[model samples]
Target: MSFATPPGWYPDAGAPGTERWWDGTAWTAHTRPPAVVQHEPVRQPYAPQSFGPPVPLPPARGGGRTRVLAITLSGLLVLGAATTAFLLLGPDDSGTRTAPAPTTSDPAPTAPATASASATPSGEGGPDGDPAVLVDQLNGITLAVPDGWEKAKNTPDDAPTIRTAVSYDCPGTAASFCYRGTVSTRTARAGRTDPKAVAEADITAAADRAYEEDILGQRTHGGITSHKVLKAEPVAVAGRTGYLVRWQVVTAKGPGGVVQSVAFPSEAGIGTPVIVRLAFDADRPELPVSLMDTITRSIRPIGDSATSGGVGASIGP
Candidate 1:
């Protein structure tokens, strides 16, 4: 439905007692405290009554009439004061009341620049400090990493599935690292046409391979076990259609490992689709999956950065 009111401030439908901007087509992020409206009591001229024969009464003494007039005027004054007080202090017709002045503690997102910055998602907190913004010129993507997370030094140079990879390890962990998140721009094989299918296969293979190695290392006695794919579904990443793959180990002992990956193709001319994976021990709560999702969704392709469909075309299976 269209806005019946012209472009201006209106009570926010989502938040009562707050004003939101109606930008003709839609409500904008811009909002402010509601405006207060004060009503005043209107004074009407007092008309004197004429006592006719039907309402006959004895004539008043010299100052009796004056006293009566004085008392009547005083009562009118009191009534006027009461009406003014009610109008000033009583709740509005809707039972909602706005402050006398707009609150300034939380300013409105009226500035386009401020709104834009806020629109970009970032980690709530990072160990290194405030979340740091990292822009990958080579991959044409940008994301925010938690503070205190250190980037791994050994990024593979010859991994085919990963054109370039950047891994961040959380603080307070030894060489093995406790929690880790990685962003990689994947490159398909020389003749592979469907990157989505390749990505899916690569994701599955990675999970199986990782679990196999884990079992072989732990089970020197030759007991074989497998990892399980918890979920695999089509997802919209960075405006591009992609897939989110989640898998976990099936072991009775120790901390079960979990892997969450998001893979999608890049838009035309913006290299291949990238995949972001976050892995951690199920026992540790350090791994932030929501932050991982934010990083994956923040990716942007080289020339198609302005487009909302992420870094790639909107094609997925």
Candidate 2:
């Protein structure tokens, strides 16, 4: 039958006992038995049918259930993808996302080490605390305190001096105590710059002060009637070339005494000249002449490692 005929089940002329299903344009293989009619029905006109190969059918329409199932599957796939992403890239327990760790090519920063109080540099105030050492900060030098000697307690702070621990009444005047040995240091006054000249010029005054008279015009060491030069020569002190002059003075009322003046360039300030004066009783067995050499050899720059005075330098005869 042609498409003008509506789609329905009709009697199959080719197979009389059964009815076949006809779509709008063509017949399908579906079939069922003919129903019984209670009375004679009107007959409709039919065109002659030819038997040919069956034609392919188009897709079915109005498939609401199939469309709904397809949509549900797509939604599940999308939800599963979102859940996977969140689990792999979520925040930590702290509620803050941590950055990726640095690779070998990118190094991490490190904090610097802290310094301790004990790490202070050497020689600043190291020797000042030693009882056997005398630190002269103004001249930037240190002297070894010899045996039986101590720092001069009565000396002014501006003046660095040391003396023998023992003292005796002055022979010429009983008003004051006389030390058997004394050593004092000071920056050179505005006079001679040459170390040798300074030493030579200071020796006479040193002798007079030690034995001749005191500042009050009293004979502290009896009376200095004569003086003799014991030694005068160039010496090295605290790594600098210097000079020293030693003199023997004869006193009137007691055994004579020896005096010495040493001058050198100071290593602390602007290379100024420094003078060290020494006085010792000649007759005292403990205050030998060689003690002067020992004390001079023990001088050193404030920060130097050498405690035996200058660089292999000697003073006095």
Best by lDDT: 2
Please identify model 1 stretches exceeding 4 Å from their true place: 1-131, 156-183, 208-224, 251-253, 268-271, 302-317
**Which candidate's TM-score is highest?**
2
Please give, for residues 217-295, the per-residue lDDT of candidate 1 as tens digits. 3321122144777777888865678877777765343454666666666432224555555554455455544545555
lDDT of candidate 2? 0.66
- lDDT to native, each model: 0.43, 0.66
**What's the residue-level lDDT of 90 in candidate 2?**
74
Q: For residues 194-310, could you state the per-residue lDDT of candidate 2 as single tens digits?
A: 999889988887887778887668888788898898999999887789999999989997888999999998765424588888999987877788888788867887657544322
Once superposed on the true structure, which residue ranges of model 2 sit more than 4 Å away at CA?
Answer: 1-125, 156-158, 308-317
Candidates' RMSD to native = 26.3, 49.2
Worst 10-residue lDDT window for candidate 2 reads: 112-121
Q: Count the backbone clashes (under 3 Å) in each candidate.
A: 12, 2
Query: What TM value does model 1 have?
Result: 0.41
